[model samples]
Target: MGAIICAASLVTYTSVSAEEAYTLTIKDHRFEPAQLSIKAETPVTLIVKNLDASPEEFESKPLRIEKIIPANSEANFTIRALKAGRYKFVGEFHEDSAKGELIAE
Candidate 1:
């Protein structure tokens, strides 16, 4: 009985520690919902979906993330818990149009 209880507790902890998820879509070299708001000091799972016919590289200097998302597909990224501030990101293929920021508060 104790072993079962311990196993259940572990499962609960695992779920609680899982990263929060958010989605961003790319179409016409632009990010939908260009500004994202998230909780500070919480790990995040960012799902970037590319709707265009060309691939795009998602780059964020502050987040230290640089990933290539293939055309008409989606990619997942794990972001560590962040401090309260804004982290900017851009699409390498279309920096002028594809720009976004993550605001953690």
Candidate 2:
């Protein structure tokens, strides 16, 4: 879990919000929570850790961010939610199965 915590801390480190930035993990072919509720319009950090030995891509069209998370590595990005919306994203390399979402509040 060293990588996961590192990814999360990378995200949290950039934040100055009282709401607190959160860490999201991707492992076992799934996004752990699969769904997330975050403070809307607040600058949020998403640290994506890919535990698999294969490269994975993370994307959220509604959130307008796409990142390539290397095998056993992580990617960090910032997003500001404006309102409640379901942002659907997935691994481009494994789009058929590696999928997930972001539920903003």
For each candidate, the alpha-carbon lDDT, in order, equals 0.95, 0.76
Clashing pairs in 1: none
Model 2, span 6-71: residue lDDT tens: 999988876645444666777776776777777776767777888988888787777787788888
Candidate 1: 10-residue stretch with minimal lDDT = 15-24
Q: Give the per-residue lDDT digits (tens) of candidate 1, residues 1-105.
A: 999999999999999988889999999999998999988999899999999999999999999999999999999998899999999999999999999999999
Please report how far candidate 1 places residue 43 from its true position, in Å: 0.3
Top candidate, metric lDDT: 1
TM-score of 1: 0.93
The TM-score that candidate 2 achieves is 0.74
Q: What are the TM-scores, per candidate, against the unseen true structure?
A: 0.93, 0.74
Give the range where candidate 2 is weakest over 10 consecutive residues by summed lDDT. Answer: 14-23
Error of 1 at 79 (Å): 0.5
